[model samples]
Target: MSETHDHSNEHDHATHTHDGKPIQEDPLPSLEAQILEASVRELLIEKGVISADDVRRAIDQVESRTPALGAKIVARAWDDSEFKALLMSDSDEALMAFGVDMRPTELCVVENTDEVHNMVVCTLCSCYPRPVLGVPPAWYKRRDYRSRAVREPRAVLQEFGTQIPDQKQVRVHDSNADLRYLVLPQRPAGTEGWDQEKLARLVTRDSMIGVSDALAASDIGG
Candidate 1:
């Protein structure tokens, strides 16, 4: 993908994994960066800029950010039409329900439908929707996926065992520092009369990434 982002053109899925399998974890930062972080943390504590407790709390907060949050958002969108419209329109306002603040950056929610499939990638870097989807899967941050997703999305999706029909258009969105995206996958069938909580079980990280569809209701014995 080019550095220039053109949202107008429809572009497509690199999976964090296939069929909800556990994806490889993202690698740690470079040793230099790690050392720098530690030094900065200690210096802050020494200078009374922040407490050790504060550091621990911040670590916990980052750890707590996960795909489950995004799943809840998707499930809510499926169950509540009004909220879904808000998400598709004013995403920041809709995200308020989850107590998420996307101030310096904006979250754009793209939906996958029968006619068009969608995917997210950061060609420039690993700019992801962290507050909503947590850390991106390791593959999403790799050079191969970053480059190939926009060029050969259908082939990439095939590698992930996702076969989009020829009739459906595949669209790829490039994420950046100031803008991020989350794929609002289509709700699966056979889920009538399901509550939000129960419906949430069908949502998965890969589906929200647009690499695959939500878990079939029968998959969970629903």
Candidate 2:
């Protein structure tokens, strides 16, 4: 009898394993990209194009911002009709009233209603309202989300556990360098007498991004 050989097994063993354990490939691209970015930043600083202090200050400013500020704005809007009107018309002014410094980038507030649902995305890049909502989430910066958001917003929202009825209009906003979007989620029912502070607790970061709805009355021990 001739000895039988399994070439496919040999090939798999060679490519996918070393000794008895599976070979793990080095995931260095992210580290390499970070190193390249640091190198470029150092070069720019050396060239006097931008100073180290400038970078530090910018980072500090970004770090100082948080989603709580956005929640306050949303809650105020939900409680006060006049503020909601102002927010929809001029978000910067409305935010300024709350002591939020949203300069340089114009904020466009999209209101979610019974008839219309809104979603925000940055197709070109992750341009977001950092002053109001802090840094964009990692998932938001992904190319897949940016592309899919505009292409199929309802489906994207569904994945985020937000189900919009077919009868309602789904509006997708693409944020750019000059303009960023913030979604004003509809006020939840059964909270008619809720104060701004209590209402703010119901406004989540994801709701402001339009990926989820405001916390229901039952969600926050209400």
lDDT against the true structure, per candidate, is 0.83, 0.81
Tens digit of lDDT per residue, candidate 2, span 1-222? 102334444332211223321212322234445777899999999999999999999999888888899999999998889998998898877887877766777888999999998889877667888889998898887766877888878888899999999999998888856888899999999998999999999999999999999999889998
> Runs in model 1 with CA error above 4 Å?
1-29
TM, every model: 0.83, 0.78
Give the lDDT of residue 17 in candidate 2.
Answer: 24
Candidate 1 vs. true structure, TM-score: 0.83
**Best candidate according to lDDT:** 1
Clashes of 1: 2
After aligning candidate 1 to the native by TM-score, how far in Å is the CA of 189 from where it should be?
1.2
Q: Model 2: runs farther than 4 Å from truth?
A: 1-36, 43-54
What is residue 74's positional error in candidate 2, in angstroms? 0.5
RMSD over all Cα atoms, model 1: 8.9
